[model samples]
Target chain A: MIRFLSILFILVSNTIFSILEIEILKGSDNLSKVAFVPFGNESGIEENYGSQISKNIEKNMLLFGEFENLAVNEMLSYPSSENDFYYRDWKVLGVDYSVIGKVNSVNALGNLNISYSLFNINRRIKILEGEIVGSEDNIEDISKIISNRIYEQITGLRGIFDTKLAYVINSDADTYQMCISDIDGKNEQILFTSKAPIMSPDWSPDRKKIAYVSFENGLAEIFIQDLQSGERDSIQALGMTNSAPVWSPDGKSLALVVSFSGNPDIFLYSIRNKRLVRLTNHYGIDTEPSWSPDSKKIIFTSDRSGSPQLYEISTKSKRKKRLTRDGNYNARGRYFPDGKSIFFVHGNNGNFQIAIKKLSSRYIETLTSTSLDESPTISPNGNIIIYATKDGSNGYLGGITLDGKARFSLPVKNGSVREPAWSPLLN
Target chain B: MNKVLTSLNTFFLILLFLSLIFSMFSFPKLNIDETQSIKVNFYELIQQNDILFDPPAANTLIKKEAKKTSAINEKTNADETSIISKFKINKLDIKNEITKIKLSKEREDILRVSAIIQQRISSIWIKPNSLSESLIAKVLINLAPSGEILNFSLIEPSSNTSFNESILTAMNKMTFFEEVLSLERKLFEKNFRNFNLVFKSSGEIE
Candidate 1:
């Protein structure tokens, strides 16, 4: 009888336990605050490299306005090692996470060893710890590596602090220079200078070379320039005019616009055998072709629907599907990093702005309110988009985070900048 | 000896049957009675707009009136059929008014406490946005009667590792719901002692 009573009691308890469950779907509007503490310097180092490295990382993490920072004066205590760290020090300041490190001298030959650790204040656990060994000359590079690791650990997304950007700079009306630089506008290098217009600079998959359209021969022709050797080679596709060259993900082909005689169409040119295959045959103009992340389909703009609209074509099945319908001008569609959505220049009421649309949905959401935005390029992590916009007749690069929480502009160049292209992440 | 063993087995079976019948009837009595439910319907049908906002003395007056009516019904003892029926109806009306206040008060407490728990979790959970995949996970939380969180387990994990990790990190940051202390002992044990929190991702770009 006692055993039978226990079985009945278990059944009765199970029913009561299953009755209540609460679902949480919304998140807080507040951003996570991170505290970057200045590292303790070794006795022999004279450069103050400890604070310099921490300052650089702080700037990089706050570049996209992704997180808030703690003021140095507000810190109750500055601890440089795991033994001295305390969760109560940051918890009282409402900090979500804290980063601390120490600088050590490896030897008398000026080599430095830096050890860092990241902690979650609320959970009271050490999340990450690492050490980097580099010379004083590579302090900037070492800072970038540490920033990437901390950012990835916090957000679970790939770190893109090392990616580069390629664009065109027209110092004068006639002199056009194609330039590449670090994403933060550092290490600016001019790849080529021409007396004609330069457009559509795209980095190859391996990032060793860049393919761009140059009119140096008094005609729109595509050229691939090697960064290390400074060598230039043309695609040499038989066409009267060619422009807008975008590399395929495999680095074996280029999706470009070619007008054989008069009509502009989309074609895939193989780089190995120099073979050109026609992908689109239409009386209407087709241009600005970009490969999907999966390389299975190519998204382009065409006038077949009476106005410029976005359409995608399957490379395998050759089937076509229209992506935008509400506005007449939806041009230069490029897929997000995941290939599940696309962003393009949306024109409504004569205002050209950056907008995104999921391939599975019909509605479009605009990200920017600028009137003359174009040539939007997404970061490798798909968290931000930078596009070219007009600032009182001088074209400059404007950027906005996909979350719509930040708006920023790149450093102004000596001339008008146009056609910003974001490079892929380094392996 | 075999006959005696068979008889003993039959006796045990009969005892088990009686226990099952007892457990089935006890649950509803502990939860809600039919009289209380009927009173709740009457209260909602008439006084739902006002809720429990009436003066406290009104409830006491109703109790006195109900007792007076019952006293009259007993004194009449079938001598006045119409009078007795009228008193019985008045008594029932008074009983319903009281239960209406009781049930709605308990329900209001439940709703208020549930909202606080949801808001607390949402504030602390640093949601990492993949912005590409739609996913959901469920976490079962166990809390002590003093409103301290005893344990939590991820019963249903999402396909994205980051999403699951964020949820677990958020749960670890919390040590107590403490708001449960304001709830009645029975309510806390029934609803919050062991409950599941369903976390969902909306796939918004933000």
Candidate 2:
């Protein structure tokens, strides 16, 4: 009896100790609105450093989905110093956050002082501030670095502005080639050429390799290409009609849809064990499999339930559950960065709009009203999705914040762009 | 000699059993009382302040108003004046109808608050009972800013932590705030700044 009581006390103490774990603070659902005034480079440098910094910060803030950067023209007042900050001016504009920075010379040392701070307009508090020392030539590089630091301090996710995006650009009507560009759609580097239609280019978890379904050999084949080496090889499989190769979170396997068994089904190929584990064995099409953050489950669109809807399957237990129930076309589902919800393309009345499904309650909210919004790729921060939409005569890659704000288009020169895959943050 | 030795062993065993029995009752009784005392302190503090628990209903209305249409919520807290001096005793019936409408609207607002808070709390790790003082101000301002969270880096992250799990947990847990929505107009839709949330320990749990 004494021993029993001792065990009971130990268990109760353990429970109490466990209950005292740290509790996380919940912020508002409303994303932060920040205005980045172009950095003033007073050193008479040829490059407009302020404009560049503003652009860089804008791209980073947009990618995180948590921030909305106020347009330069929209800001009512410009405050450079503490005296310039009028809280009422910001209050009238409904501006929640404001950022101001300057680039100044540091004597004969040729070092530059880049000082910036993030201010909370609503609370009238400066949330973040820092200064960096860099050479004049390194201002562009320094701006990128500071932008990342500021981004992480606010969004709690690494910024992907410094990361590159690989997309297919229509160089001409007959030429659809794969090109890699900065996240802002700059510094375009053509990686591969395929007038035969290159589709579905996905970044590996580590951002080292790109797995894309290329139609080079007159058939759809999943090719894993080394970004640094430019060496490419196809994943060896039984038959053709394999596409949409999504890398596992561990980067040890690829979850893809293969039609080798005469019907499209989800298949997992292990890079280590060299074994293929077939997950979905249905007659209906099971395509576009995205790995959950845990890498234990794969969510894909299947018509197994009479209409196209999103379904999730456990990689270990092989158990499957339906995620979307609303529409006849709910396909190309991707997991949010936190793995709490899934975002997919929902079609109704012949229009495809972006929709998100809360995994626990299966509540679906249609986000986009624009038709032909195909191939939604969420940023690493899970704040926004960059997808392809038809803009009049051509196609453009545009991004919309998860909260459904103003959509911005990535400038693709004279060509219709599609299948935009936002890369993970580059280390 | 054998009889004496057996008696000695029996005496030792009896003493050990008695000690164990006494400790089993005494130690837990002391510890449980201490924990209970801490909780009682929290309750007393809340009662003294007169701050409501912010029921789930208010949380939901706030969320819908923030998400669906910004116009519907711009004119909040407008009808709180008493109709005392304007010969309004004859118009009491009309006033009662208006009060009923206002009460329902207030209830709806409470429902909205409840919904938003429910989802927010589920994600974040807010300390029990200490939320009103420790987190309410910062969270309300940061979330109600009408924009996405930005510049959310950590200060003095532990050198031992490789993944920065605490920071990630804090960011994921926050979904919305009540104060950010109360501000007028939707001016800055883009940029956001991070708020450093610090927790303080109260004397006891309520």
Per lDDT, the best of the predicted structures is: 1
Q: List the candidate 2 regions with Cα displacement exceeding 4 Å.
A: A1-95, A104-111, A135-138, A152-158, B1-206
Deviation in angstroms for A176 in model 1?
A: 2.5
lDDT of 1 by residue, A1-427 (tens): 9999999998988875465778888776667899999988878777788898898888888877778999988999989899999899998898988999888875576678999999988778899999999888888788889999998988888888889999999999999999999888999999999999999999998889999999999999999999899899988998899899999999999999999878899999999999999899999999999999999999999999899999999987889998999788999899998999999999999999999998998999999988999999999998889999998899999998776767889999999999999999999
Instruction: Assess the local accuracy of residue A168 in candidate 1 as a C-alpha lDDT between 0 and 100.
Output: 99
Task: Please provide, for model 2 over A42-103, each residue's C-alpha lDDT reduced to its tens digit, 9 standing for 90 to 100.
Answer: 66655566667667666666753455667788887776555667777766776666778776
Residue B176's lDDT within candidate 2 is 47
Ten contiguous residues with the weakest lDDT in model 2 chain B: B77-86
TM-score to true structure, per model:
0.83, 0.60
Residue A341 lDDT in model 2? 79
**Residue A356 lDDT in model 2?**
78
True-vs-predicted CA distance for residue A290, candidate 2, Å: 1.1
List pairs with backbone clashes in candidate 1: none
Q: Give the Å error, residue B122, model 2.
A: 22
Question: Which parts of model 1 have CA positions greater than 4 angstroms off?
Answer: A1-15, B1-105, B144-150, B172-182
What DockQ does candidate 1 score? 0.44
